[model samples]
Target: MTEQTCGVRDVVDLGQDDGDTAEIHDECGVFGVWAPNRDPARMTYFALRALQHRGQESAGIAVGDGKTVLVRKDLGLVTQVFTEADLAAMPGKVAIGHCRYGTAGAKGWEAAQPHLSTIDDTIIALAHNGTLVNFDSLRRELIEMGIPFRSNTDSEVAAKLIGYFTQRGHRLRSGIAHTMRMIKGGYAMVLARENALYAFRDPHGIRPLVLGKLGENEWVVASETCALDIVGATYVRDVEPGEIIRISDDGMRSERGLPPADRHDCIFEHVYFSRPDSIKDGSSFYLMRHNMGRRLARETPVDADLVISVPDSGTPAAEGYAAELGLPYGTGLIKNRYVARTFIQPTQELRQRGVRLKLNPLPDVVRGKRIVMVDDSIVRGTTSKQIVRMLREAGATEVHVRSASPMVKWPCFYGIDTANQDQLIAANMELKEICSYIEADTLGFLSIEGLLSCVPSGGYCTACFTGDYPVEIPKSFYEEKFLPGYTPHNPDPSASDASISISDIAFDLKESENGD
Candidate 1:
């Protein structure tokens, strides 16, 4: 790793090349509040910073100072964009913030959200975390109705649709109800306006949104409980799937708009996406991952002297696996903390080599030991194969592979960028075949039942594993399904099928001024 100085910060330059593979992100992160008497923007800034791990592409905050919504957003990390001055400039008692990693479409400032729409006299700011499967149909419908879009984001359509309904004399809650009926995908949004803040989750609850209370006067809504902790708020509970929560100075109220035909929280949250410190749907993410590792050990016993995890997401599970098998656990790999999510590489092959820049095997720890490697999930199998090879080169006699989640067979339509079916190794090959292909001595994945059991609540979307979608699956999907569309001059069909690589998805939105 090479170190370079940027402005007073030392940026570590990990010289690994980039790869053509794109990993799907779990969801986006969003936080919003109506603390009219407090500096809600500062609180939101901190909350978004805490949830930054969920997304790295862009960050922004919109403040409604009981009047106009003040907004700022850019394509960069939260810390890189929201300076103290920027946060202070956004002073308001009510604020909403979003951290986004684009799952599909081109990456640009225009796509960086806090998507604001004006209808009649009202302006609504929307930040969404999940994908909309029916976005094409919805976009066409809105276009036919003369609504012009500024970005290629589905959240904009949802915002415009809500704005249109609210302008036509429907209440905010009623507009949400009407909009929910038309959207067919996973969504967790926080909508804020001049006088109110609204939070809602899809019927399937494929994304996560929760409510919290800070003191007696301030109420908070966020994508995860971790964000609540950041703002010194006590976690209230998860915003139930299909539930609409309305918050204002008059106190909080909730109205159930629709009941889930099936409760399917995204299973990947526990396995790889969410912060270990977070509590989702009453389940401890850290504990759930630990249990998954323990179960993986029991189900797929292997002879190994040490258990090692891929850093960050895979650490807790590796510990659990080690404890279950009475094997020693050690920090066998280290990740360079400063690597940007999207690094510019000279070529696609060079990019594939970039994973090593982020992660490197600790040769001293793994040398001469039979290692059991635990990771969250295996998508295209390229990263896993690369990691395994790195371990072998570091002198491991054997590398036994295990995934904390079940094999993902189907692509996700609800915001997650697991877009191409054929790219998934588990989708096409048997366990034994995959093991050989990846050059692992043995490979084991958490069972779908085991995954469901790990969750605090029984309801969650394991569609990627079970191939059972909670909502009606769309016959066609957006081009930004898993990978960004190629430019006219540079078309790479292979790059277009890569999975969405961000960790989580959640967004905060505010109703347009006209209430429509």
Candidate 2:
């Protein structure tokens, strides 16, 4: 990583952009732990590290042991935000943490969460993963009622809403249920009081939340099964949609936060957001992607000398593609795993040079060959076009690009940061037009039916592809709900309170945003 300033940045990053414009960004990741007599902070840290791919903008952890609560979070990666000493200082039996991308609030320390609020003589810490469609209205209502807020995040709104209800007369679980009824949208939230850890999901299960056990009494909950794996916790089961699970000294109890309803869990979790190793319900994400690729090969017969994936995200599908086609798989594109976020002079040539820094072609492998490039999906078409051009320059005679998922024609409001529908290349063009635009000899996307067939037991959300939303979405909110573009606001060194510096930027879109 390049340092524009002399000092090392507090921001953390792993280098190399995948140069694929058709990428989907994930929303957030949340993890919590309740160990009877052990400090759960370290366990929470390792779990957050495993979930780092879920969010890169910021991270934080909060811990408590019935009487005292301590929080440590900042705007960076888990490795950058906390040291051994830092975790050692806060030794608590219960803890929860968050890794976030600035979706609901401005990009600053104020927006980072594990938001804390003390109301009615009770202190609550919350870390959430998902968007609240009605957050704006709720925030305004709470403001008018004389409830003070600490941050500009929708997470804080939910935390305060729970506190507001609790102060009135409801018990903690009852207040959470009341708050759940008042809110709309997908959420997988982990909340902590002095002695208990609570995990809850939206009524629709639009996001993922799993409950796990470390031993006889310890319990854990996280946005994905991967976090549970990182902590050596055995997967217990998925928290049911509309379920609220409380883990305390007595034991773990499950209660419904919202009434039972049809589940429309985000399909992207199977397609992108989740770690490949994670198992959702009974289906493995790895096996699902493999099925998509195997299906792609059967659906689209291509005359190619070899097949290759874009890298980690596209690898599984590429493996299936090669196996089904009986074609050899090779690493035609070598990704620079360590070249971090860097600033180049703002020149046209330098911009193109940056793409090469992320991915360089293996001339010996693709030279004079017909190549079929398998990628998860394409977004703006800019990165795909560049990659195709790069392949040609390396002496590839033809480039046939295939996407494992259907075209994304709509913007996602349930946490994913897909560019506006207008920004999506597929939203504006036909298959032939998109092929020509990206300079691919041919381009194919897996059919929606084919995508769904991978999972036999399915109630997944494909709203981004079919425009069929499971939950109520305020379409008008899109213009402001997700920011117009990908860039975070530039930091000014002159500002005394600026938490960011030239050295510490976890830069945007260029990196591997493999999941939604």
Candidate 3:
């Protein structure tokens, strides 16, 4: 066990560049276990570290020892919290863990999860991934019923609701079923009790939850398949929408409940949210993104000397695009492997600064050449503009931007942290306008058909791009303002108050009823 104390400043010093950025949405990762031969907490810690890219705000683990549950959580990176000694202290064979990025809760220790509850003389610990559109209404109802709340998180409501039902003489699975019926929006949950571990996904499957096997007696549930791979587990299948699976010493059992009339797995999981190595619903994420880049190159051809990727996630797709266009592929940008994800930064200033410190353009390769920069997507245009400016300053003759996914026009009510519609540059601007704003010579985005074709399984949720939600979304759904010390800057006085509230917008179209 290596014992070393390193702070955020020390980590920042290890960054690779000075000025380059990318727009992205923040997400959470969840992992759990039922029965295992080894200490489940240590395995979960490694799994969370593998999924640290999906979230960075906090990391936690809850373990069950057949009679009691023990939990440990804190606000920081996973590596910072779970040391070898910490792992050794957490003794258990069944555990559930979480890596959170605050979709709808305060960014403090209280909101960090694996929320524990004692109801009906049984300890239940929960770790959730996804956002609930009806959180406000649910909170009000729970408060009215005299349920003492400990944290300002939407996930807690689900835990309390399930506890409430279980206390009324309902079976554990029945309580979860009843709670699921009342919730509205996306969720992939892991529920732990004295002797069992349970996993479930929302009816619409807006979020992801996959099942894997470690050994003959051990079963695992994780937000992405990459986690399972890191722990030497074999991918079994995804937890079906509206289905609950229980794992105990006896073995694994499943119950199929009422599924939503529609199914829409989050498309961003393939584009930017998930690790490229992960396999979602039997579809290779790397291949899907690579195919998207290939299609983008065909639809919007650009005369460029070379194609360069933004690094990490963009590298695979850029290679595909270059192959399709017969252009020389070069490493134009170098990423700082040690830099933390900017989207996970709690403050706006920190997010902006993090991006600048994350990536740098390689002047030798891009200088005196026409560069086609391939990236996954652009959200607010802040990162895109900065990256374009960096390339030009680095002596690139012309910079052409290519996006592997369609433009994001609508705020996601499922789980992603895309709250304000106005903040989205693509939502209000045309393609030419967006290109001009980003100062790019040319800009191209993947078409809807191209995105759908990329997926081998032929099912995805592109609601953020096309406004086609798979379930009945709340008209008033919006991300809850929960970051403790963070606040938005007020708009200029001279500007008109064109901001629209959630209730006024008619989000549901007639096509939503058709369940496409």
Candidate 4:
């Protein structure tokens, strides 16, 4: 194992124009490979780079040789964390990798994964994506049972839980199944041992996990297809909800860890988290976003001479909007792609110049133009406000702001790190008030129905937009966080066992340990 350090820096991407707030962040990305003849560690590094958009705070890889497990991780972007020497030193047949943007733990070296733990006599490393809501109580129970912990992350809790169960006489897959039934919330996890790889997902399927074929016997699993493409693998299928897939010299096997619940895939993947080149639900994210823009234009038409996007994230939608209305489409702003992170602390005066550091207006494209600026979503409205002002100052005659998705009014508990309700500008301000706040001549958000129509047909957890959650949240976890008069809708109360007693759980484990 090896570790390195640097000051904790905030990564600015997507709609984080001001750099003060990242409107939203997917929890992390996970990738694992089971290819004996291949350079699995190098494959994992390339895969993590492909999934880098999902996380930027940390990157790590754990490789399992025939005899032991080795891990190298640190707090930084993937490019900064590992080098050719590091990868060349760790030769292994199986490996799991992680890139994290923490939504459930502190931003420290210990919180970065793939988290290492021991299961009886063997070493195992686990990489996880998504937040586990009931982890605090689980952590306490494990601690009471003499289990030690090094970090406050739910990922570590999951690792220790699997270790605890496996130490008690059950097979590793059975232990994983037991852990799956206990933890609640959205998650997709990949675990690596000395000679094998295992991948699993939550019952509700709130997070994504896909399996791919490297050749014949070699198999790989990752958070997105783009990762598979980067590693020269062929898409196989999604690891179904509540399913456990194990790959090794034994080939591949799958079984139900828990009965699959109603699907509640995160809809925000289409909005921002996924790269445009990524494929989801039989369509490229680019096509889905393009359809969203077309739907948004029909629903909220504005008088404008040109249509522009918040660069990169919003480009597809803006192009579709221009095509639908026969309006001219041009690049009004150019982004400084090099501005991924800053090492120096930003002063209050420097903070005011935040948006300018990442994006600049092209006067030639927007001058004398009545511009409609399209963005993926508006959470706090700070970035949108700065971008709008920048366009106006660049000689735009009038500026109208359009959000491609519905207003994000509620906090997300699945995996996305959204602001508190009071901090969410859309939750507090009316449409007109938000328009005034951002200093735009007009502002419009796509309706929930309109937004859903643009994506593939499936159940989605739109909790951030409509306060509808697929899994039940513990009252203790969210009672104080929800705004007054807002009732969270949990469609299926029977789906979650978060309130299950710890004593009953302990007793069950004891019975299993005794071969009852």
Candidate 5:
């Protein structure tokens, strides 16, 4: 395997606007291709490059040459992990790739995915883009059967389930179908076995996944349509929640794993996760963000001379706010894109210097004037405080901070990186307290109503704001979900092994690894 590094001076992690404090991240991205007579691995590489915004810590691509599954993954950006020669060496008819931020499990080379496992002889490689809430339950169940796991990642748990089910006389479809029911929480996954590519989503469709046509019969499945665009594929449609699609040289066949239920696709995609050029749930990403900024302006108008963004993610919202309020918009913060994830553990001094390292206030824009700052969300309140201080230091007479989305007060167990609610400033502080905490003259957030006005309410997950989870999470799971190093024990320790039956988990292998 070859490793490469292009001379990219500045590479920042994507989908994280909250700086320093509780860097809210989208978590992971998955991409795959099924193209006969073509180098599927190469296409997957490029597609993963486009979806890199979704993940940054590690990358891998697995290719199936109709007989053997080959995998290479390590902790790094896509560009740093794979070279052109590496892609050329793993030529195959089908390929699946992953860029990981690790929503669940520890971060390491061992945990980096496109997790490869053998379904007896038919090798399968899988990439995942979400967390599984039933992790402890499933792990303990499998452990009871003496089935050991290879990694700490929940994706490995999924791979083990597939391998076990396939080994137990279930067809690839049936195996995946059963596995889907056993798993819970948000996920968009791509798996390749022997000769076919399979993609599926959570029953609630808590994460985004879309299908696209490359040329003629060749197809693509990915976490976002933006990946499809990068690979020169024509967008098809989103994979229906709880639906499974298997792609091969013959064609594509689909089946449902779970019946259509209350759709709860993550609302964060339109708010901040996706690229503005991309589309989600038939809505334009740019328009959604623009409309959010529009609603934010109307709902939370502040007296200020000019509007400015917190650099990149906040740009569209700042522009919309400026236009809506009839105030001039200007670039008050200059971002140095080259400075990305630093290796050193930031000291308190270094952390305090965080804003200057990435963003420098353009004094000329804010000098002796009132300024309005528009940002996506406030996570820990530290970043907002730093930003307000930066603006004040730049000669702004007053600073008003406006957030496009409602305050994120709850932990997102679906796929977001927020681990504990205790870290959320909104979860703890009132608006006036938050304003004082951030050191801003005023602070306002778009109401849930105002935020929903920007997009259709149906199928959108607003559990972060409303706390009404579409899928019921066991109360046993919450405190353990974010509290690090917590061990799992039955709520009733008196429970017997008979509590979870393995009678349905058979061990026979006589079905096709693919539909073929």
Candidate 6:
């Protein structure tokens, strides 16, 4: 793979943060295409752009020709990282792509995916969408075995694990199955070798992955249906939990990699993670969020002259809330979308400017009006407080804030980069206290049950809202990291079924080797 040096213009990337904090950050996105005649790299590029809302820090694509796997990746948005010539150079049949927000590792060039690893004389690249809770111990074990590592990332750990097992005489699918059984936490992964592409998901279905059909032989897989739609692929079905599907010249093959546990699809995908156009269980996320707004209005009615939203993300819910309450809906704030990212160091004045760099209120719309602001969710309340102050400065008489989702009191262990329990505003403050902190005249958050009612019916991971984790985290890890008052609840006592000891895995591998 060739690395091209490109210069970035001098500006501040709001994403990198100039000391101001965002309410919530996004997780990662992954996509894969197994199209022979078509331009797989270009298709992946467009798909990554479609799924860009899922991540913004970095983007990468790996193309697997019949001879070798070639990758082009860097720390920037998809548009910034790739030129037309870059995609033209990588001609291949099978490909996988990733956009990263970096919840599991450092936000550096090395941490970008599709993470490359070698098995015997062959090469493979893996793109992952979620976090692996047990990766730290697994990395240490591999290190002691003399396996070299390039980055401290869960994705790298996974790539190495597959290579480790494959080098032990197992087939690539077997290696993937073994790795799936061993790794813990929520993940949706796409792996590509010289001629084949593989897609798999965690047992609990805590993350999302979908299968799509392009033509007779071509196939596509992605973290969301929106990516598939962008590439003209028709959605087939979700890549079933704990299942692995491999596509190649031999056609597609599916196998149970791990026994499916209780389905705990991430509810936040409907709340904020997935794109508005993305489909989940026969409904669009935009529709779901709009429903959430209607439910919120019924649960907590507010008397305000106008209803507005934080911006693009919260607009659907804001409209729904306004329609349901018979209140006027207007654009009280304008967002500077181009100001999403920058690298320039913030001076003290710029730090004080904060959210104004990204958002500004329109005095004509909000002046002398009682404004009700709707947002998807609030994490640290930093942005919310700043926005409230901005509205007041724009001549808003009284500001009321509403969250479409329930209070995010517990930190996420899946893919989302959430604050710790102590840093979470809701976890530290009660309703009135939080309202005062944000300087909102009034504040209301949708109830957990109310939120569930708005989405398509299925088991959901409400850990961030309810502290009920579908997969069990080690008590020691939580005890050492989190505050004493916060304890995660696992609904099923039997959920730790996949917590097999490393000795057991070794014994299992040895038995299989002897059988062969």
Per-residue lDDT of candidate 3, residues 157-242 (tens digit): 88987787666534788778767766777899998987889998897788999999988879999999999998899999989999
Question: Looking at model 5, how many pairs of residues clash?
Answer: 4
Query: lDDT per prediction?
Result: 0.76, 0.78, 0.78, 0.86, 0.80, 0.86
Off by over 4 Å in 3: 1-22, 341-354, 478-516
Please give each candidate's TM-score.
0.87, 0.87, 0.86, 0.94, 0.89, 0.94
Q: What is the lDDT of residue 69 in candidate 1?
A: 80
lDDT of 6: 0.86
lDDT of 6 by residue, 1-516 (tens): 122111111111111111112746656999999999999999999999998888888999999999999999998899999999999999999999999999887889999999999987789999999988778888888898798999999999999999987776468998898888778889999999989999999988999999999999899999999999999999999999999999999999999999998899998898988889999879999999998888788777778999999988898899889999999999999999887544566898988888888899999999999999999988888899899888999999888888888888898888888736777887887666677678777778888888998988888999998888887776544554566777788555355645575446657777889997
Off by over 4 Å in 2: 1-22, 339-350, 479-516
Give the per-residue lDDT of model 2 (tens digit) for 364-467: 99999999999888777877888888899999988888888888877777888873666787777656667777787767788888888886475877888876
lDDT of 4 by residue, 336-409 (tens): 99876435667899776978878999999999999999998888887888888889899998887888888888
lDDT for model 5, please.
0.80
Q: Which stretches of candidate 4 lie over 4 Å from their true place?
A: 1-22, 491-495, 499-503, 513-516
**Tens-digit lDDT track for model 1 on 205-323?**
88989899997767999988999998889998889899998888888898996765467778777787789999865667999899988877776667789999988888888999899
**Tens digit per residue, CA lDDT, model 5, 61-96:** 999998899998988888889988898799889999
Q: Is candidate 1 or candidate 6 better by TM-score?
A: 6
Residue 269 displacement in candidate 3 (angstroms): 0.7
TM for candidate 5 is 0.89
TM-score of 3: 0.86
Looking at model 5, residue 299 earns an lDDT score of 74
What's model 4's TM-score?
A: 0.94
